[model samples]
Target: LSFSLPKCDTMERFAGRVTVYSVVGCPHCNSAKAFLKGLGLPYCEVDVEKDSTVRQKVKELTGRSTVPQIFFNKTHIGGNDDLQNLVSNNGFFSPQIKKKKKNKPSDLMIPSIPCFTDVKGERDNFAELILEFKSSGIIKSHGSFLKVHKLTFSGSELIEWLVDKKGFEKDQALNTGKELMQKKFFSDVSGKGDFQDGHTLYRLIEHDCLTALNSGKTAECSPVLAAELSEALRRLILKLYGEHLSPDGKTVDYKAMENSQTFQEYCELATQLQRLELKSMTREEKLAFFINVYNALVIHGHIKMGPPKNLWQRYKFFNGVSYLIGGEVFTLQDIENGVLRGNRKGVGQLTKPFSQGDQRLQVALPEAEPLIHFALNCGAKGCPAIRSYSAKTVDAQLKTAGEAFLEGDDGCHVNSCKNEIRLSQIFKWYKVDFGDTNEKLLQWVAEHMADSPKKKELKELLGKGNHKVVFLPYDWSSNSKD
Candidate 1:
């Protein structure tokens, strides 16, 4: 099919036979096709894997074995990157179109196309936007489609909300909704159509619902008895750790967890959290429950929105993504700094997580537990290992966790020659919980460490005064299984 270029000074009319060489399961190939479709251009796609001869021809012509070698009227255009660069530079329409010498493409600016990169940040941002829609009463389950009840909203309503609430132009909002649909964020209720600006009912996927609870939805059945719910959460986390997490908890198979039946069950079970009575739980029970929930929630967040890539993304991830429990929403930041840390302000925060009037404050511990630094895993390479905690054995479990983390190079290191000790950044961030001073911090570390040569050295160093404390840089790389 012929395609026309937007109005340009030099090129009045343009049409070309666009073709794309592709293969199954190639992400870049799919992106190239989406880019073309977004531009309203129709192209012929050839699967090179089906025939050796065509594959050889492609390699010979492009001098590359990549599947997505695009062409315009048989003129080679390299791969996905080349197509984007050509378009962004306004050099795709004609040879006679002069490139402006003064307006060279900026090295810092990368051309972006809709659905080009599966950026976890954008997915997360979109998910939060959808949650906002739900909270604003824009999305509801009150409508019936084909005599069957479904949690859904109309496409026009979504587009309107995006435009009015998010400040997106009508066209931009439509494209944004389409991108969300392609990413499986939501789908037409009948499972047969793309997102459109019309009265078509669409439902958010099951996994997306984990991030936010229904605005006023409560359990129809008697709350799964607290005992049963607690036990189920414990068992589910244990199963998840056994099947998808490494023995040391440094690596996680999030991809496998995403597809497992256990995870799906966990998602279904999370809804029951709304009915839980947190005030009745003992401190030990709260410790175990919050720790398990925190670790599992990190994995759940990763599966729903990809792992955070930078400090800002991490900030959004820890503060934005959450689960609705006991009719309250608890973000990763809330559970850690609010409940587990006794409602103290977390690192880089200006105020406490829970206010005096907030209901969540009732669940906060009287004081921060120091050992929790070792039990809480933030899905980062430098974070402590993950393990299932049981209320009956939580104290012992946390002690073990603290000991295990201290033994690792990432946790503590002593350089006697320099009269200094290097410790995990966790100590620096929550030094108040540890002791609030270098001497006290060292003493606490020395006392809690397991009996080992390093522990002995740390103790000796602590006894001797004038030792400098250095906190190692925390690694924020994803602890994902390759």
Candidate 2:
């Protein structure tokens, strides 16, 4: 007689009420509400298209004009992407039921303990397994092309060992290996393909192994290193501002900067960044350090490589410029999308700058900080003004910058009669950072704007709802003092 493993029921429990702000004819809104229903989650849907007052209320509460904005217990959860990300990553609501299997042998009994409970627990178990594998003599050095040496083992060998020694089925063993790989325990030696049960060779990542060895204790930022880097970068930026920037901070004299002794000193100092210990930085320190470095790097790239003149050149300029920091090379794209934006994938990019095994991933912020859009200057006339930031004052400085930028006509414009608001293209490009919807974007703009007639007008329009959003054309001319 055939017998199977016991069936298990897993349920996802949410702690609060679910609400969806929707609009008529919004497919995403419909799908979002449907997803909640499918999961047996009861949600209150507010069709903003029908009620202008409710639309205004949603704009005030969540700062979003888009439909399908979700909330759990009154906490804003953004649009469909935000909802999906929350559900997938945070497990906000989950429920599953499975029927029990027929009687099985004791040897085939399923363990009550979950294979992996949490990230920390999984890492601990994977580390122990690695040590066990080492003791079992399954992992060893192998020769590859060009007489290169790699400490690795075949996928099939690991699966075979698991099936025979650990009593796991072949398929189960294969999946377990893949999970270990996903957790960054090991990877294909050539950095190609996923974990597979074949002759494919895989090796444990050294940094991951070291991390596991330390009992998963994350590295602490060195105060001395952070201070030194910050001070050096600050001095360079200040010197540039004093020497080459226009009094208004709107134009740059790149030609003069390229020929100055200060530029040489700046170049030499940048080399020292190779020793920057990212782990030694606090959030404030990191924000200040990276912002200054990014601004300085823009000037450096402009002088050294010349300003990018077209779309392809702009791509190359952003993606190719690099600095060796902490033994890793970081490009302009790396600083903006990887470091500042918390390792998010940038526009026109398929993946994040830092991969799973990359040491730099440890330096990324827990999430993207929206205020950074105001601090980063891309060496263009339309970009925000450059300024040196201090760890103690970065937050205040960014707020000041945001307010200053929004006060300008180029940053924001309001037309009460037309019910239209025009914003800088920066808002358009990094919409996700701002709020992911027109309503939220406008709310953010209004909030950051200085106390002015325009701010009051925008607020009044938002309060009434049914307004439109337009992104101003970006001025890409070089911020040159010609």
User: Which one is best on lDDT?
Assistant: 1
Q: What lDDT does model 2 reach?
A: 0.67
Model 1: per-residue lDDT, tens digit, 254-369?
78888999887776666556545688888998898888788767777887788999889999999987877664678999999999999999998999999877878888899999
Q: How close is candidate 2 to the true structure, as a TM-score?
A: 0.54
TM-score of each: 0.55, 0.54
Which lDDT values do the candidates have, in the order given? 0.70, 0.67
| Model 1, position 107: C-alpha lDDT score | 19
Which one is best on TM-score? 1
lDDT score, residue 454, model 2? 85
> In candidate 1, where is summed lDDT lowest over 10 consecutive residues?
113-122
Query: Residue 245, candidate 1: how far off, in angstroms?
Result: 6.0
